[model samples]
Target: MALPKPGTPVRGSTTGRPIMALLDLLGRRWVLRILWELREETLTFRELRERCDAMSPTVLNQRLRELREADIVVLEEPYGYALSKQGRQLLEALMPLQRWSEQWQKKLAAKADQES
Candidate 1:
């Protein structure tokens, strides 16, 4: 499958706005998990698969291929798979969202506890 890119049609938006393209790619099953796993360091295919709860090899391979095509992941010599420069930047951009999500979760949990 062709990876989503700006200036071309993407799943959610015909115009393929940059953010839409990114979301289209990230929306695929296991895509975010793969990126998250690679956030810290490289991992061999086996190690990554294990960390992902032994996901089907076919899906993992497909996701990795897609990530590489998007320039978000790269395979280094003897180091397995790691995030590329752009990927790191992407993670940096997401840090704020992560913090927000944690805060949101806390609020939700507190509300639930109060209800209980």
Candidate 2:
């Protein structure tokens, strides 16, 4: 089924703010991972599945469908699946978040070491 657009109620969101909609979609299992995996190259369904450590085909297909609907990914001839321009832009936008996560990981590790 097609997902509701921004400004309409979506899962966990009654206000339907666009950011909430985006977060709801991204929060689904494997969604962010799928996008991250596609950052560099196009991959066939099987390749993507393998890269995702053999995620269930059913879930992968579902996530791909949702991404396509969101205009973040596309299926192409000969190339299988690749990120669309919008997807690339989104990934680029996420670079800062990626950097932040690396720092956050280090901080957590340090805290864990101190506690231990």
Candidate 3:
């Protein structure tokens, strides 16, 4: 789908269509994890990799590029990726989803145990 203009109200989106684009970006492999890792503090490329359980450097680099292009991530003076203001806002917005995910995880685990 053609992306909505920046700052345009994302049609068909309560949060707006722009948010769908956001979700699409975050849904990519390791993208959400990268954001989660950046939540506490900014880290150098190597540091990000280490905290990411040593994800392949190639994959990490690619995600960073996509995030930067989307203005959800920025490379700081010291050469570490940090969330842009918009990115921080997006992360904060997802807090409720994070709680929901934890609950979902527990529920699935319980179901698996029962099945076993």
CA RMSD per model (angstroms)? 0.9, 1.4, 4.2
Question: Clashes in each model (backbone N, CA, C under 3 Å)?
Answer: 0, 0, 2
Give per-residue CA lDDT, model 2, range 1-116, as digits (tens).
Answer: 45646998878789899888888888888989999999999999999999999999999999999999999999998889999999999889989999999999999999999999
Q: Model 2 residue 72 lDDT?
A: 90
lDDT for position 23 in model 2: 81
Which clashing pairs does model 1 show?
none
Cα lDDT tens digits, model 3, 2-115, are 333334445445554655656666667898999889987889999999999999999999889888888888999786999999889989999999999999999999999999
- Model 3: CA > 4 A from native: 1-16, 108-116
Worst 10-residue lDDT window for candidate 1 reads 27-36
User: Which of candidates 1 and 2 reaches a greater lDDT?
Assistant: 1
TM-score for each predicted model, relative to the true structure: 0.95, 0.91, 0.75
| Tens-digit lDDT string for candidate 1 (78-106) | 98999999999998898898999999999
Whose TM-score is higher: candidate 2's or candidate 3's?
2
Candidate 1 runs further than 4 Å off: none
lDDT of 2: 0.91
